[model samples]
Target: MKDLFSSYRIKELELKNRIVMPPMCQYSVEAKDGIPNSWHQHHYVSRAIGGTGLVIVEMTDVEPDGRITDHDLGLWSDDQIDAFSKIVKEVHRYGAKIGIQIAHAGRKAQDAETPVAPSAIAFDETFKTPRALETEEVKGIVDKFRASVRRAVQAGFDAIELHGAHGYLIHQFLSPITNRRDDEYGKDLTKFGVEVIQAAKSEMPASMPLIMRISAREYVEGGYGLEESIAFSKVFKEAGVDMFHVSSGGEGPIGAAGRPGTHASYQTPLAREIKKALDIPVIAVGRLDDPILANSIIGNEEADLVAVGRGMLRNPYWALEASQALNKKVAVPVQYERGFRH
Candidate 1:
C-alpha cells in the first residue's frame, strides 16, 4: 500500500516521497517589493534537505496590491525571477520537486490601499471593503494570473497551484457569499477560475501538471459544502487541473453551530469525496501532522498525498523525523545522516 514515504509522480513532476510541504505564508518579504530573499531560499531548501518530496512555496500574489500584506511574496515583475530561481535550483539539487501557490488575496489584501474583489465585500468587520472588478477589468486580472504563471515557469518550478481557497480572489468569485455580481462572472462562478486555469496551462509546458487548491467546504452557515465542491471540481478537472489540494473554510465567520471540528483528519472525508466523485488525485491537508495518520490516509486511499503545515514549521525536518518514526527508509543528506542513523 502507498504510504507517506512512498514515491509519487504526476505529469512531469517526480517526487522522492509522498510527504508534501504545502504553501504556508512566511510573510518574510520585508522589502515590500515581493522578492524572494535568503529567508525563502533557506526556508524551502531546508525542507528539501529534510526529505520532503514536494515543497510548495507560499501564497505568491500575482500583483503588488493582490498581496495579503506588504511582507508577502509577489511575481509581478521580472526583476524577482532570479531569487526564486535560486530556490528552485537548490531545491532540485536536494531531490525535491517544488511548486508555487499563485494567488490574489482580494478583499483580504490587508496592505492594499483599497483591495479589489469580485464584489464590494469586506472580508470581515476588520477588513476594508473592496472595489468590485468590471467585466473587462476581471479579464485583466486573469491576464495577471497568466503573466505570473509565465514567470513561475521561467523560474523552473515543477508545478503551479492556483489558490482557490481561504477567501482569496478566486474563492470570492466562486462563492455567492462574496460574488454578488450580476455579470457573467457571478452567474457562472467557475468562469474566472476556469479562465485562470486555462491561461496558466497555456504558459506551462505540456508535461507540467497544474494543481488547484480548493476549499471543498466553506465553514460558514450559507457556504457550500461537499456537494457543491464536487460539482465545481468536475469542471475544474475538465479545465486542465491535474490535482486538487483539498481544504476547507475561509469563506466567512463560523458560528457556534457552524464551527468546524478541530480533530485530526477532519477534512480527509472532503478530500476522499472529491477524489471518488471526480476520479482524480488529491492532496489531503489540515492538521495531518502525525506521520501515522498521514500515512494511513495514503495507504487507505483517502488521498494520494499528505501535506504537513505547522508541523513542518515547528521542525524543518518534519519528513525526516517522520521517516525515522515510521521506520521507513528515506535518503538523508550525508551531512545530516549521522543525526538519523539507526
Candidate 2:
C-alpha cells in the first residue's frame, strides 16, 4: 500500500515521499522591496534538509499591492527571481522539490492604501472597503499572474501553486458570498480563476504541474459548502489544475454557523471528496500533525499527499520523524542518521 513514505508523481514533478510542507506565511520578508532574503533561504533549506519531500514556499504575491502584508514575498520583479533560485538550488541539494504559491490578497491586502476586489465588499468592518476592479483591471491581474509564473520558471522551481483560497483574490471571485459583480466576472464566477489558471499554465513547462490551493468549504453563514466547492473544483480541474491542496473556511469571520473547527484531520475528508469528485490528485492539509493519521490518509487513498503545517513549524524534521514513527526505512541525511538511533 502507498503510504506517506511512498513517492508521489504528478506530471514531471516527482516527490520523494507523500509529505508536503504547505505554504505558511513567515511574514519575514525584511526588505519592503518584496525580495526574499537569507531568512527565506534558511527557512526553506532547513526543511529540505530535514526530509520534507516537497516544500512549498509561502504565499508569494504577484504584485506589491497584492501582498497580505508589507512583509510578504513578491515575484513581481526579475530582481527577486535570482534570490528564489538560490533557495531552490539549496533545497534541491537536499533531494527535495520546491514550489511557490503565487497569490493576490485582494481586499485582504492589509498594506494597500485601498485594496481591490471583485466587488466592493470589505472582508469585515476592520478591513478596508475595497474598490471594485473594472473589467480591464481584472484582465490586467491575469497578466500579472502569468508574469509571476514566468518568473518562477526562470527561478527553476520544480512546481507552481496558485493561491486561490482563504478568501484571497481568487477565492473572493470564486465565492458567491464575496463576489457580487454584475459583469462577466460575476456572471461567471470561475472565469477569473480559470483565466488565472490558464495564464499560469501558459508560462509553466509541460512537465511542471500547476497546483491550486482552495477552500473546499466556507464556514460562515451564507458561505459556500462542500457542494459549491466541488462544482468549482471540477471547473478548475478542467482548466488545468494538476492538484488541489484541499483546505476550508477563510471566507470571513466565523459566524453563527460556526467555524470549520480545529481538529486533527478535519480537512482530510474535504480532500477525499474533491479527489473522488474530480478524479485528480490532492494534498490534504489542516491539523494533520499526527504521523499515523497522515500516513493513514495516504494508505487509505484519502489523499495523494499530506501537508503538515504547524507540525513542520514546530519541528523541521517532521518528515524524518514520521518515517521513524511509521517504522519505515527511508533515507536520512548521514549527519542526522546517528541521532535517529532505534
Report, for all candidates in order, the number of backbone clashes: 0, 0
Give the TM-score of each candidate. 0.97, 0.97
**Pairs of colliding residues, candidate 1:** none
**lDDT (Cα) of model 1:** 0.92
Please write out the lDDT profile of model 1 over residues 1-342, one tens digit for every residue. Answer: 788888888987888788999999999997899998989999999999888999999999999999999999999999988999999999999989999999999999999999999999888899999999999999999999999999999999999999999889999899989999999998999999999999999999999989999999887768898899999999999999999999888886422123654778878899999999999999999889999999899999999999988899999999999998899978888898789866
Candidate 2 displacement at residue 218 in angstroms: 0.6
Where's the lowest-lDDT run of ten residues in candidate 1?
Answer: 252-261
- lDDT by residue (56-97, candidate 2, tens digit) is 999999999999999999999998999999999999999999
What does the lDDT read for residue 81 in candidate 2? 93
Model 2, TM vs. native: 0.97
Off by over 4 Å in 2: 253-260
